[model samples]
Target: MTQRVVVDPVTRIEGHLRIEAETSPGGEITGAWSSGTMVRGIELILQGRDPRDAWAFAQRICGVCTLVHGIASVRAVEDALDYQIPPNAQLIRNLMIGAQYVHDHVMHFYHLHALDWVDVVSALKADPKATSALAQSISSYAKSSPGYFSDVQKKLKTFVDQGQLGIFANGYWGSPLYKLPPEANLMAVAHYLEALTWQREVVQLHAIFGGKNPHPNFVVGGAPAPISLDADTLAATSVNVQGLEIVKNVIARMQAFVNEVYLPDTLAIASFYKDWFRRGEGVGNFMTFGDFPEDGTGDPSKWLIPAGVILNRDLTTIHPVDLNDPMQVQEFVAHSYYGYSTGKDTGLHPYDGQTNLDYTGPKPPFEQLDVAKDYSWLKSPRWKGNVVEVGPLARVLMLNAKGFEPAVELTQKALRQLDLPLEAVYSTMGRTAARTLESKIVADQMSTWYDALIANIRKGELAVFNDAKWDPSTWPSVARGVGFMEAPRGALAHWIVIRDGKIDNYQAVVPSTWNAGPRDEAGKPGPYEAALMDRHTLADPKQPLEIQRTIHSFDPCIACAVHVVDPQGEELTQIQVR
Candidate 1:
C-alpha cells in the first residue's frame, strides 16, 4: 500500500517548504515531492530601477541569509559594468563573507539542525558531572564544568515545567532514532545556548565593516567602509588600528569555538550515527560558483574555493562552471508556477529568465498539493542538463578533488576517526560532516585574510572603492553579467541586464532554489526529493524524524515563501509552520 504523507511548511523557524512523500507498506519512502508554496517576486521589483541600488532590494530577499544577496547583487552590477574594485575592497568583502560563513554554519548546526539528531527531553535525566566529562573528553572548551552543565539543565527544566519545552519543542524527543545518551544530549543543549551568545560577538565583524548586519550596506564598485588611520578619524572608520585589533579578536573567538566546541561536538555526535553515512546521497552531481578572491584579477584559479562540477561522484574529472554560458547554466520552470516565453518545458539562461506567475496549484484550505501539476514556486536549476547538488558537500568534494591539502587531510582524518572509507562521504551524514569540516577550514583562514588587510593598510593601499566607472556616461548602452558566490548554503548567483543606465532584467537563483526546487522538464526530482527517497524509511509515520534529518542536513530555507495576500489585504494561505 502506498501512503502519501504531507509535511507542509517544515521547520519551526521561517521555512516555506512542503514535502509530500509516498511510502511503501514497509514505511520506506518510494517517492517524494519538494514544494515552495510562496511566490518569489524580488527580481520583478528590480525592473527599471537604478542598477546600483538593486543590491539594497535584493539583499532583502532573505533575513537569515545575512549579506549573501547583497554581495551577489553588487558583484552583478560590477560584472555588468566591467567595474573592477581595489584589492582592499576585495579583502574587506572576503573578511565580511568569511565571518558570515563561520557564524551562519555554527548557528545552523547547533540551533536549527541539532534537534533533528538530539533528544532534548532526555537531557533532564542527565548527570551534569557526566556531561562535563563528555564535554572535556571531546574538546578543551573552558565551560566544561559540572556547575555549567547543571545551570543549562535547569534552564531546560524550567521550559519543560511551563508545559512546553520552549524552543526545543516539536521534535521527536524520545524517538527510537535518537541514539545519543543523556549526557551527550545535555552537553549538546548546553552548547546550543552558548552558540546564541557566540553569535552576538561574531556579528561585530559585519557591524565594523558593513555598518550593520542582517542586510548590511554594500556598494556596487567597492565596499562602503573607508580606510583612515588618523587618530582623529579613527573613531569614524573601520580600517584603523583599533578596529583591526577588534577584528583580530573576533577571528580568535571564531577559531576557538570551531576547534574546541563545534568540530568536537560533531565528531562526538557522529560516533552514534555511523549507519547514516550510507544514505541521503542525492543526485551524485555537484557544482560550485567559487568565491573569496585574493586579487583584483578576479580569476577562479586564485579563489580560495575553486569553482567546478563533479558528476556521478567522480572526483577524477572536475567540469568547469560558466555562469554566462546559456547552454551550461539554465533554469527550468516546467514543474514550477511560472511561465517562460520560450515554453514551459524550455530551459532559459538566467539572463533571459522569466518570472511570469502562472500558479495552478490547489486552492486555499487545501489538505494536500496535487503533485501532478505546477506545485512549486522554485524553478529547477540545472548545469548541462544534469541535476547538481550544491552546498558544503559540493565545495568539500571540490576541495578534495582539487587536492586542497587542508580539505583532503581533514576528510581523511574525519573518515579515519569514524572508521569509514572515503565513499561514506557521499551520504546525508557526510553532508552534515562536510559543513563542520569546512567551518574550521574557513575559520582558521580568516586570520590569514586579516593579516593581509593589515599589510595592505601599513603599505598605504588604503582605497576601498573604485571610482573609475562612477559616471553613467562611461558605461556601454547595454550590458549583462552574472555575479556568483558559494554562499553558506551553496551556490548563489544573481544575473542582471543593464540598459540605458537602468536595470533591464534581473534574476537571482538562490541556493534553496537549486536544492528545494520541483522536478525539471524530464521529470527528475530535485536534491531534497531525491535524498528523501535514498534509503529513507519512517520509523513511525506520525513522527517523521527521518525526513527532518535529511532535509535539515541541507539547511533548507525558502526565502521566497513570502505572504500570499488577496486584493483586499487578507492572507490567502494561513500556513503556520510550527
Candidate 2:
C-alpha cells in the first residue's frame, strides 16, 4: 500500500513551497514532487526598462536576499557593456557579498533550519546547570551559565503555559525524530535567540556600503557609494573612515560568534544525529559559477571560489562551465507552469529564455500534484541535460576536490570529530553542516577583504565608481551578457540583452529554481525531489519532521526562484500573514 503526504505553504521558508510524497507501507518516502506555488515575473517586469536600471527592479526578487540580485544585475549590465569597475570597488563588493553569506547562513541555520532538529518544548524539561555544562564542554562561548539557561527556559515555559509558542508555534515539539537531549536542546535554543541579535550587527555592513539594505543602491558601471575621506561628512557619506571602522568591528563580531557558537553547535548536534550524515544525498552532480573576485578582472582565475561542474560525486575531475554556451545551461518548462515558443520539452538557454505563463488550475485540495503534468511554477534548469545541485555543499565539494586548504582542513576536522568519513558530507546533515563551516570561512574572508579596502584607502586610491561607460550613448546598438555569483542559497545568474539602451530580454535562473524545480522533460527529479527520495523515512507522516529536515537542508528561497502574478499584470492572490 502507498500513502500520499502533502505539506503546503511549507512554513519557515521564504516563499510558498509545496511538497507531495508517496510513502510505502513501511513509511519510507518512495517518491516525491517539489513545487514552487508562486510565479516569478521579475524577469517580465524588466522588459523595456533601462538596461542600467535593471538592478533596482531585479533586487526585489527577494526581501531576504536583498543585495545578491543587485550584485548579479549590476554585473550583467557591466558584462554587456564591457564596463570595468576599480580595484577598490571589487574589494568593497567582495566584503558586502561575504557579509551577506555569513549573515544569511547564520540566520538560516538558527531561525529557519535549527528548529527542525532542536525541540523548543524539550528545553523546558532541561536542568539549566546541565545545559550550561554541556555548552561549555563543546564551545568556549561565554553566554552559557546556569542562570542564563534557567532564564531562557523560564521564558519559553511561559510561552508554552500561555498556549502560545509564538515563534516556536506549530513545531512537532515532542516528536520522536528530534535527536537532541533536553540540555542540548536548551543550549541550542539560547543560541537561536543570540543569533537573532547577532544578525542586526552584520547587516550594518550592507548599510555602510550600499547606503541601505533589503534593497541597497547599485550602479551598472560600479558601486554607488563614493569613498569620501573627509571626517567632517562621515555621517553623510556611505563609505567613510567611521563607516570602515564600524565594518571592521562588525567582521570581528561575526568571526567571534561563528567560532564560539555556530560551529560548535553544529558539530555537537551532528553527534546525536549521525544517521542523517548517511542519508539525504541528493543528485550526485554539482555546479558553481564562481564569485568574489580578488581584483576587478572578473576572471575565474581571480575568483575566491572556483567555477566547475562535479559529475557523479567524482573528485577526480572538474569540468569547465560556460554560461554563454547555448548547449550548456538551459531551462526546461515541460513540468513547470511556463511555456517555450517551440515546445514545453524544448530547452532554452537564458539568452533565449522565455517567461510565458502556462498555469494549470492549482485549485487546492490536491490529493497530489498532477505528477504527469506541470506541477511547479519554477522552470527546471539543467546543465548539459543533467540535474545538478548548487549551494554551499556544491562550493564546498568544489573546494574539497580542488584541495582548497581551509575547506579541506575544516571538512577533515569535522569528519574526524564525528568519526565519519569524508563521504558523509554528501548527506542532509552534511549539507546543514556545510553552511556552518562556510559561515566561518566567509567571516574570516570578510576581514581580509576589509583590510584590503583599508590598504587601498591608505594608499590614497579612492575610486569606487567607473564613469567611463556610465552614459548610455556610448553603448553599442546591441549587447548581451550574463552576470553570476554564488549566492548564499546557491549559484545565481542574470542574463540580459540590451537593444537601443533598453532591456530587450531578461532572465534570472536562481538557485532555488535549480534545486526546487519540478522534474525535467526526461522525467528526472531535481535536487529536492531526489534528496527526499534518498533513504528518507517518515516516522509520522502527520508531522513530517523528516521531510522538513531534508528540504530545509537546501535552504529554499522560493521568492527568488518563483513569483506570483497573472497574465493581466494584476494580483492573483493576496497572501495575508495574520
lDDT of each: 0.88, 0.90
lDDT of candidate 1 over 353-399, digit per residue (tens): 88898878877668877877888988999999999899999999999
lDDT (0-100) at residue 22 of candidate 2? 97
Candidate with top TM-score is 2
Summing lDDT over every window of 10 consecutive residues in candidate 1, give the lowest-scoring window.
569-578
> Compared to the true structure, candidate 1 yields what TM-score?
0.97
Can you give the TM-score per candidate against the true fold? 0.97, 0.98
Residue pairs in candidate 2 whose N, alpha carbon or C atoms collide under 3 angstroms: 39-563, 39-564, 40-563
lDDT by residue for model 2 (68-108), tens: 99999999999999999999999988988998899999999
RMSD in angstroms, all models?
Answer: 3.3, 2.6
Model 2 weakest lDDT span, ten residues long: 569-578
